[model samples]
Target: MAPTAFLLVFSEPGPNVPEDEYNDWYDNEHIPLRVNTPAFLNWTRWKAVDGEKPTYGASYDLESYEATKKAPYTTLAETRSDREKGILANIQLLDRRHYELIEPHPIPLRHSTTRRNLPHTSSLSPEEDFNKWYHEEHIPLLAKAPGWVRSRRFILKDCGQMGVEAQKDQKPPKYMAVHEWASMDSFKSPEYKAALATPWTEKVFANVVAKERRVMTFVRKWARL
Candidate 1:
């Protein structure tokens, strides 16, 4: 089977609209429209933790680049256009990124991970804290989890704003960390649980990370190149 790719979209609530309303619009209209698209495989949504303002995330999976590229125009261009007109019409666009799945070793699993833009904050000490914890601690821990598979990270240089304007008082982080898990169940394994429960996790997160948002979903293939 061809590996799945993920399209991640990140954004903050608009100036005049309320977060709840935006979320409702997404759940009721946007998601349905995307799923209804011809090549769309699966979708999911998540909210950011520690975010100064509400942060929303969505994930879309397609069989292959060819399928992904062709599906929207063939199946749901009209629906997508309508959705863009409503929810995304006036909202401040934050970030968008495309990710290709990492090939798993030993196991036949396929998955990809990507990070949208991240906001900057004075309290966020990326050099001494975030980077250290992520590289030294978090990555290693996840690697040790059950069904451990190949993983990769990417930094989106020109993705867009990441809710920084909502909190004008703080500076946004220059980088975002993206992690790929072989399977959702693997991430939920006992080893993973213990890793996150450790003091190291607490120490790493202490005062550095204000919020985090994540979403997971299954993928389907429409066309392959």
Candidate 2:
């Protein structure tokens, strides 16, 4: 079967770097390097409205996580011009990871005003049990939240560090869920709160060894299916 994956990145400008210059390089130079690749289906950018730092996030929908380790994708960075390196040197990457789709949602990919990103790792429960809760119980409840568009889940396949002052050999959680929304209203809604209040949710989440919750608003989209 054809593989499906995501290249997710969170970042911020380095100290003394102006936001305009950082964004200019990302929009005009950095992102262009990956846009034309056939394996890359689409790319979207976002800014944090709430939650974790590094503030900026981007998602690259790809044919497979393995595509990132090959040919043009690898060559893009290896062959970066001095100017590209210069700009990269002034950026700070908070997290960079590639993940394969585990649970695909029905809603066609489209623009959304808000999103909630949950990246986590599990330790206590058996993998099957943890996933069973998410697949059979958790998502259905979350789906009932007002303004919810869709929710997709993924499993990490590869990860690496980037940018100046980047963390040394950093690693993120193994699983992630991307939840789309029409507005921020879903987060504080009764249904959303109730979803988290379930005893099953507590049981499963107790096994979540590490996690990050980031709420972001759409900034722009570069390419699409």
Candidate 3:
């Protein structure tokens, strides 16, 4: 299979960590170890433009949602070098979530250099209406916006604790919508606003229990060799 699931990692270097060293470790050691696995397809990283604290986002394509719990992937932590462990200790992890694709676009997404990440949870019981509204009305209108490339929706399958010691049992929102853009300008365009301003959009959003909006800009991408 060509990666039907992904792992979303949110983190940032701690105040005491040097930016140069942190980036070097991430670019050289941290990402490479995971991408080297056969089940880990590709890795793409982004930085938040919304001025949020845990300012980094990384998405790792996986063979399946179960891939993270299996051999090589699960064993990587035990194989980490002392330096890698030291660097990771000083990093502040925000959230680590695993999601399986639920909305498959007619046009496949080749690459997304710029995008908006909307992770949310619904308050509606059964969530049938919420899912219906998103698939039927919401995405169609957003597709009308200029510079639209593709959209993807995923449902959370699991959550990882990482450095989140306080909320050991806490979980993130269950649904994530990743909207690809040709450029950031598309987000502020009139069509985009029109799509979001619709009555249906307002109605569905009213039932959203939790949500986080992140405007992401590309940092780098790597794939298995």
* Stretch of 10 with least lDDT, candidate 3: 117-126
Q: Which residue runs does candidate 3 get wrong by more than 4 Å?
A: 107-126, 164-166
lDDT of each candidate versus the true structure? 0.52, 0.75, 0.74
For model 2, the superposed segments whose C-alpha errors exceed 4 Å read: 1-3, 105-125
Which lDDT tens digits does candidate 2 get at residues 55-97?
Answer: 8988888888778788877788788878768767666664688
Q: lDDT score, residue 99, model 3? A: 87
- Compare the candidates by TM-score and give the number of the best one: 3
Candidate 1: list runs displaced more than 4 Å.
52-54, 71-83, 105-225
lDDT of 3 at 128: 86
TM-score of predicted structure 2: 0.87
List TM-score per model, in order: 0.50, 0.87, 0.88
lDDT of 3 by residue, 1-225 (tens): 677897888877767567788788889988888777877888888888778757888888788877778898889978989987776666666478888988575555535545444322223323787788778877777788777777777888988655523256877777887776777778789999888898877887777787767776778888676
User: Relative to the unseen true structure, what is the C-alpha lDDT of residue 134 in candidate 1, on a scale of 0 to 100?
Assistant: 60
| Candidate ordering by TM-score (highest first) | 3, 2, 1
